[model samples]
Target chain A: MDRVSLIDRVSQGMKNLLVLMLVLLTGCAQQQLRGTGDLGVVIERAAGRIVVVDSSAHATLGTVEGLGDLSHASVVFSRDGRYAYVFGRDGGITKVDLLTQNIARRVVQAGNSIGGAISQDGRLVVAQNYEPGGIKVFDAETLELLADIPSTFGNNGQRSKVVGLADLPGNRFAYALFEAGEIWVADLSDPKHPQLTKYCDIGRQPYDGLVTPDGRYYLAGLFGEDGIALVDLWKPEQGARKILAHYGRGEEKLPVFKMPHLRGWAVAGGRAYLPAVGRHEVLVVDTSTWQEVGRISVKGQPVFVMARPDARQVWVNFAFPDNGWVQVIDTLDNRLIDTLAPGKAVLHLEFTPKGEQVWISARDDNRVMIYDTLTRKPVGELPAQSPSGIFFTSRAGRIGF
Target chain B: MKSLCLLMCFSLAMQASAQSTAEPTPARQHELIRLVRQDCGSCHGMTLKGGLGLPLLPDSLRDKPASSLAATVVHGRPGTAMPPWKTILAEGEAEWIVSRLLTGFPKE
Candidate 1:
């Protein structure tokens, strides 16, 4: 062996060390996301925190704190499924890392905000606000203000309460102006400067709206009347059209204790199961015809009419007095088949990805209950401080989630 | 000193008025407290700071008359999200709520 042989051997050793370093770096990057969509988060309202749960094992992972005013909290998952963006009732938007069970970034974007949506491209986050009435868009990465679209109504520069905010395909957002009786769409492809389009006469007092699974249509619920406004995203020129024209015609409206959250309503089996406000019934609408096909009589005023992931059954919960009861409607027959007494003040329910089980939050009971959808039996329970909403990360890939 | 005297007198007057009004049963008072803290707190921040609805903090209600506040709670404002509690709360109970709210809501 000579000097030349010694130098060649040293170069080979250095190359092997560099290759080993690359392999270790790749392993560290992969370990960052230790969890998957099988995990879920339950909103503990009074505690102002969220309890992360393992949906598969029906076990608690950990709890994240410092979330303010979660009484009407809602959450949306990041594209990678490793983070959840929680929208608090007090206009606080928090970016939580689900893998680590911690808050990554958080911001108070408004004085009062109901809920928000993440852009389809996963680059922008927009919150629909009540105070000063507008939608605030933020950078998904840093929670920085990206754009502001005020919901200006009338001629006096008056802003109206914006509701029914849902993200549409093509990087756009659609929501209703409760005071203006109008629906607006903002194209946020540019994020910084959004192009606006408005439909002035879409009936009265649109409370909430949701986009279809394919992101083709947006349905806005009305409070001032008995109808819903539909907007076709494929053809925005047609504007919003009213459905259920005579839904409650000639019938006197009962006093509504709490306005039903339309976000919980579902479109399944080519039909829509929406709670009829002020009525103890769930109106079944044909998705294609947009006509009321049937109605399922419930125990009380249904607040959340959610369908199973397979669209086979629809579970309904009510407001106040009737809240303690949970009603299930078989989609095949469109009738109430089973009524289960979960606990006191059953506020929300969430089905697993393939609809195997559902996690329920009983605020009065101060616990989260998981039940097998097939057997309708209790599986597990996690103690919480006044839980109101339960969200699973499997929603990351679903449209109009 | 004069302003301080007036403030003390006003506080006593309000307290006397609250006592004179219909005093809820211990159970009913407990129920009302839970309802306001949880149900009403859903929209109006749990801490009563502010949320979808405006704050019900004593500082904000201090300027307003207690009678009007009680009336608003019972009858609710028209054309707003606030629903009338007439079905659930009696007029006297609303007055009691107003009295306690003007000072400070009971945590328990």
Candidate 2:
């Protein structure tokens, strides 16, 4: 071949190599998700006995101990899919390795660090101190206190409700201040000393706010007011835009004492599943429409709702049912298929990378349970020390062991 | 009998004064009751009589300032499970709540 043709051939070869690498990475992710293809459930069993149950088979698998009395915890995994951090409602974080199935280290976080988020790097963990309503940054691997960032946006005299923290790609973090009606965005690029970048004031009551999968917009779940407020994080100066839905749309005019509470939305197949606290239903919003197109009725007080990647199925857990269980809905028909009765009150649920297993954490049971997706049955359980808000790492190969 | 009657009148006057100072309209009063009984009723007593924390009555908060009391409600004490109230109560609403509490507990 001529010199010019040879150069073009070399460039073509390099392109093929990149494509092959991409395919290999995607396959490896699928392999890690093989065992946890369904759903993993975490239950805070009565009396703080944290256990993880295979939700499909309803069998207990892993166990952890010494989550203090009244020590309800919210558990989340690192971004790189290596560590599982279980945060006690009172103020302690138990860092566990997903690979080893063991508590790698434990750190006593300050105040009531109920909600947290892992950095994109999976090296730093930032949690919201519930009581004082401050921010605590920890070294994910060492489980050591790196910094306790007191919230300036949160007034000391005001009741501070820091409900949720979400990772904004890179090392930046976003947290919700329910009391102050504000969302604090901090740059954790420097994990040691996280610098406060922006204090985006959304409105009167902000519950749980999260950036879009693409990190373009930040949406806050408003409880004190009607509808979900959207903040243009890109042009944050423009303030928040209220995306009114049927949930709390007419709340101000309704004589009935019904207000939106504990609202969450999981984006899947270009749609969002938004559910109100008191309402026994789920609002389906087409992200493209920004309009409420459909609603699904779910029995019991469904608080936390999640959807599978393909948007084929949606999982919702009750907040008030005395016994504790999850509601599974088929998105195709928008109907309730089955109720996941795990015998413990579940506060939060997370899905494995490949959308196979659903992971649930019960504050009262202090355990994490895993459920298979195919059969919707309990297969195994991971003992979490007072687990609550559960999230998993879905970066690459690191997944449920 | 006369002394008892006088005490009753004094108590009524105190309550009336409390109500007037807080400037709670009948509607606002009803809203406050609903919140105290429902939202806070789970942990704090239904009547704000203090289940998890101390009572919210005048007798309980007589020693504390209205601002301090309001602050506690807005920004729950650090290191405790008491969640901050910024999201629950607005600034004006919190101050009004504190004012109502300072005026003395209403007799149910």
- For model 1 the TM-score comes to 0.87
Error of 2 at A298 (Å): 2.6
Clashing pairs in 1: A164-A209
Clash count for candidate 1 is: 1
Docking class of 1: acceptable
Off by over 4 Å in 1: A1-33, B1-20, B49-54, B59-65
**What are the per-residue Cα lDDT tens digits for candidate 1 across A1-401?**
99999999999999999999999999788566455779888998878899988888878888999988787789988888878999987789999987777789999987778889888988888999888699999999999999999999889999988998988888899999988999999999998889999998898888889888888888888888888899888988888899987888898666566678777558899999988977888999998999999988899988888989889999998887788999888899887888988899999999998998988889889998888998888888888888889988888777677
In model 1 chain B, the worst 10-residue window by lDDT is B13-22
TM-score of chain B of each: 0.78, 0.66
Name the best candidate (by TM-score).
1
Cα displacement (angstroms), candidate 2, residue A329, comes to: 2.9
* Candidate 2 lDDT over residue span A1-401, tens digit each: 79999999999999999999999999787556424322232534223334544444555546656654223345566655455677665566777654445678876766555556677767787777756667888888787778877765544556465755777766777776766777777887877767775555566666566666766666677765557777666776776677863465543321112222232346666777776534566777778767777778776545667776556888887644322778888877677898877656565677776678777765446566778877999877766655654444442222111
| Worst-scoring 10-residue span by lDDT in model 2 chain B | B37-46
- Compute the interface RMSD for candidate 1: 2.3
